[model samples]
Target: MSDGIIGLIGIVALLTLLLLRLPVAFAMFIVGFLGLWIVDGWNVAAGLLSSETFTLASKPELVVIPLFILMGNVASASGMSRQLYDAAYSLIGHVRGGLASATIIGCGGFAALSGSSVASALTMGKVSLKEMERFKYDDRLSTGSVAAGGTLGILIPPSTGFVIYAILTEQSIGRLFMAGILPGILLLMVFVLTVLILCLIQPSFGPPGPKTSFSEKRRALVGALPILVLVLVTIGGIYRGFFSPEEAAGVGAGLAILYGLFTRSLSFSALKEAITDSVVTTATVMLILIAAHLLNPFFALTHITETVGNFLAYLDLSVLGTLLFILAVYLVLGCFLEGFAMLVLTLPIFFPVVLELGIDPIWFGVLVVLTLEMGLISPPVGINVFIVKSVAPRVPLGQIFRGVIPFWLAMVATLGVLIAFPQISLFLPNTMFN
Candidate 1:
């Protein structure tokens, strides 16, 4: 049998396993092992497993993964999220759709500190949804706002998604991290605009939030300064070569913990919970990384990426057309997988095709992450939306899904702009690093 045929069957089997509700990492591991055995026999598969697991798992740069995850968990467990939301609300909560806008802004800030989208959603959702609901905000709008907002975690600095992309593509993690800043801010603006427009068109979707005194707003700004400083320092350090990515994570984690402790907010129990949560989340991410590394060799043996490249070329697509095709695939697959998993799974296959087509990897990464953001908010498996629903049980899941449409449109519009003007993503990385 042909390697191509074996590859096709392997893909089908993998999907079938996914349909059967197998865990993603396990599914990849099992199919990859069989595919390797079929194409290269058991002896090669054994050696491949042993060496790939060690190399991928023990790498020093990988230390950043746990550190960043630890920082996020600490913030979540210690209730820093409320400080973020309340501060955002103090300024905007009086305006129409202010809470919704604040939700997006808060999510963006949280995303920077934490790379996990679900963590962002759960943390922010638990804090913001009740307040929005109390203001009689439309269920759809309130829930959707939080759901769409949580996806910012994947696009913002220190994002695990960008880290994995850099590792896989051999791009500089720093450049990829730098590249995300402009696009992340652009996307945040899109969500805020979407909320404004939605409230303008349908006033019932958002009642006026309680007005804060000017003095209160001033206080709120002061409260949020620490978050702003943290973002600037971490991103600045990375871009200015003040530290490597892992070193930056270590610094961020240490400072965040100290900040928590200095305020007398981080108690012993809180600290223990934060460390346990971070350790578990970090282990989960690392395991998935190990699985992806395991699968890559088998994928190569069967020439899957090469075949994908050949197939894309055979269509004689213009650059834009090829990009659209790849985007469509990601959007569909994203429904079943989180952005991080989708990125890890498909980059090996599609990135080769993209590189061949002369597309910028940095630009493509932003576009891909934006598209997956939509999937993260849409039903029947929008994880962030589910998170919002869980936190605010009175808000119907369907309503939350409906509310996300405006932001979803905003996300799509931002994507189109990026697609048309690659410089939106590339110009920053080139100017700063080059």
Candidate 2:
């Protein structure tokens, strides 16, 4: 059989394995190894395995993934979640829909350290969902806010998705990380604003939270000083050439551990939990990475990417039309594929199209991140929505899915803003790298 037919068969088999709830890594590994064997016998496929493992294991930027995951787990195990939520609440909790706003901002902050959106959703949901419910907030609004906001895990800096993209495309990891910053922050603000507007139009959507006194708000601000410093230190460190992505992750992890120890939050059990969480998360991610490496060659063999590029060029679609087409495709795919898999599957096809259209890779990276982020909130395969559902089973799964509507609107608006004004996505990377 032709390589093209074999590759297409590989794709179907891989997706079927995933649907059967086999581990994502296993699905990819099975299809990848089988495809390689079918195309080039067991001997050649075995030859590449050792070399592929060595190459992937030694990539410098990948070190950042574990460091950031460790930092996030430490932050979660420590009492940082409350501090983050309280700090946002101190500022916005008085407004109608304030808890939802706090939830959005809190999710963003937590996700900055987090590389996994499901973890972000579960963490923030556990921390804030009850409080939002206690205040009689809309079930859909409260649950949906977290489900939506948690997606910032991959949209913000310290994003593992950006790291994977960089490694896959041989783009600059640092630039890709910075590429996420402005767009992520823009989405955060849009979510908060969306909540504010919802509260204004329908105050019952969120009851106005009790106002806090100035002194109490002051205390809350003071309490969050550690995180603010870490954010500044890490981001500034990256911008100043003081550290590379790996180094910054190391710094962030150390700072988190130090903070945990200082606050007596780093008990032996907590340390074990953090290590376990980081290990599992890292293993899961690396499994996908390895499988994707095998799968990528399928596209390379079939020349599918080049074909898509040629087709797009033949269509002679305007640059705007092509960009919108890419966006629409990701939005639809996001609903089905988990973010990492979605990225691996499409970036090969889509990156070529973006290049053909002369779109900046740095800018397109951010755009893709934001677009798939919505998938984490969209049903019937909304990963983040499921994460929240796992945490708040009392809230119907349907309600959490419905809840993401406003945040979904906000995500689309943020994407529009980034698309309309490319610099919002471009400035940080250009400034930092240039």
Candidate 3:
């Protein structure tokens, strides 16, 4: 009878739909529109739906989605991602577990360019998997490293995850982008260490790759320089306050296109394909965001965020304790839900609670994104794991999952370190911009 009860039922039904294989955007749309109509009336629901869809559709900030995606798609078409991976591999592949480390580093570099975990995993897997196979690297370590490393795309700058979080929470996209840098690098280092530890324990898991001659290393670095420069230009420009997030996206996309053409790598057909892919990806993201908007108002009508905030305060947990509890919930939910789905479902309720506790929005965004990264590699529905599986079909799904366990622990450690010192997430944003 109460709005709260109605909201609860709607959430349950939404989850049921998801379990029944409904698309996330449509499921949210159906439940959100119906719940709003039930809570208010058909007229109000119709007005809200029409207005929200148009507003989200026309948002200037949304342009970043397509542009960043285009930059990545074009980069993939141009072989820029492979060049980056080759550069990393040339430098580190000779060391024990070095190939895996190179894969992680390559994933991080590609993450900076693409900002999509699926893109990073798919691209890097195509580039690195065969090489690792040639080097006799264990399929588990090779596939696991690719899957786990790809999760960096969410935390690295130019990330769609940060973009979506910024739009949803009304946080500063540039600041959130800056905030993610150190944490992203930290996580990359942790993953490299995980590879080292795994190889140290079992010497053959990731056998050393062939040593490259100094000339080969130099050539590889030269080949990747264009991408490295592009990454620095876009992310560094934003950090320096020389460009807004949208402008940065435009600049990055333009540069990606020019690079592809100048290198004679992206033909007209490939360029068209890149544009089509970017459009489709951007459209999917926009629809999900619009659906989230619908559900958000319905949740507000039920006072769920307020209710949850009140309950959190009633418990009187210390700020750290409360934060940990929230993250634990994300960890559990990650097993069953896709990362963006979890973000849309939970942020409306939890973000307000985070602010009430006086946490920094930028810092919290990094933490939340990192948790989402965990979910991307989490079991049952680890989307990145599945992406890697698709790339290396010969490797059993269970073995890939098993391989991710060490990297998953590495993620847990990274989370703990960030939690212990929030400045890890905050320092770059504060120092570089403020």
Candidate 4:
């Protein structure tokens, strides 16, 4: 059989494994290893396995993953996330649908610290859901806001999603980080607007919360100050070229630990748990990266990426049409596949087409990440919906799914805006780097 045919078979096998509910890392590893052995030889396959694994494991840039994860874990364990929520609530809780809006704003702040949708959703859900319930906010709106807002974790600065995309595409992590800023803010605003409109339409969906006095607002903001400063320092330091992304991560992690210790909010046991969680999460990400590296070489050997790129080129679509087509595929895959799995599986095939079409990689990275965010709240496999359900167990899964629909549509609108105005994604990076 032709190598291309072998590649196609390998892809089918990989998908079969995934559909069988095998772990993503293992499924990719199996497909990559076997495909390499079949198309080249066992020796080449074995050599790549060892080398790629070591190469990814020891890479300095990847240290950002563990460090940023640790920062997030420490922040969550130490009540920084709670402080952020409290601050947001104090500032906005008096408005109609204020509680849900506050939850989204808090989610955005926590996302900056955590760079994890699951963490953002879980932490904010724990902090805000009970409070919203106390205030009689509708479960659909409350749960929906958390699910939708948590997705911001992947699009904001220090995002693990961007890091993975950067590694896969060999783009500058800093540039990608910068590129995500404006688009992230835009999505956050869109989410808040969705909450406002929902509350306006139904009124009962979100009741106006009690207005806090200025003193109370100041106190809440003061409580959240350390995290706010940490975010600025790490992200700003990167923008200013004072440190690389890895250094910024280390600094953020160290500061988070120090703040927790200083405030006596992070006990020895909590700190230990944070470390353990960070290690486990970091290991999982590394394994996936290594597996992707292996899988990419297999595709290269089979010339699958080239063949796919050629096929797309022959379609004679406008650049915008081609871009939209690829994004549509992502939206479909997202319904069934986990976000990271979908990313690793498809980027090798689609990214070359993106590059060949002269689409800016950094801008494309932002667009791709935004689409992944939509997938997080999309039905069936909506990971963030599931995360929200775990936190708000009394709420029906169907309710949470219903809640996320409006926000999902809001995301769709935001995606359209970003596509129409690519400058929204590119402006920050261009201004900062150029």
Clashing pairs in 2: none
Clashes of each: 1, 0, 0, 0
Model 4 clash pairs are none
Tens-digit lDDT track of model 2 for 1-434: 77777777877887788778787778878887777888888886777676777778888778888998998899888878778899999899988999998988988888877766777788989988898888999898899888988998888878888888888778988888788888888888888888888888888989978899999999998987888888777767897788888899999999999999998977879989899989988888887887778777767776667767777788888999988987898898777777788887778778877776689999988888888788888877888888888888888888887778888988888888888999988888888834
lDDT of each: 0.83, 0.84, 0.92, 0.94
Q: lDDT per residue, candidate 1, 27-106, as tens digits?
A: 88898888888899999888888888898887888888888888888777666777788788897888889999999889
How close is every model to the real structure, measured as TM-score? Answer: 0.97, 0.96, 0.98, 0.99
lDDT of 3 by residue, 1-434 (tens): 98888988998998899878788899999999999999999998999899999998888988888999999999999999889889998999999989889989999999998999999999999999998899898888999999999999999989999999999999988899999999999999999999998999999998887899999999999999999899989999998888998999999999999998998998999999999999999888988999999999999998888888888888899999999999999999899988888889999999999988899889999999999999998899999999998988899999999989999999999999999999988888887755
- Estimate the lDDT of model 2: 0.84
How much is 260 displaced in model 1, in angstroms? 0.9
Across residues 353-415, which tens digit of lDDT does each residue of candidate 4 receive? 898889999999999999999999998899999999999899999999999999999999999
- Which ranges of candidate 2 are over 4 A from the true structure? none
In model 1, the runs with Cα more than 4 Å from the true position are: none
Superposition error at 139 for model 4 (Å):
1.3
10 residues in a row with least lDDT, candidate 1: 425-434
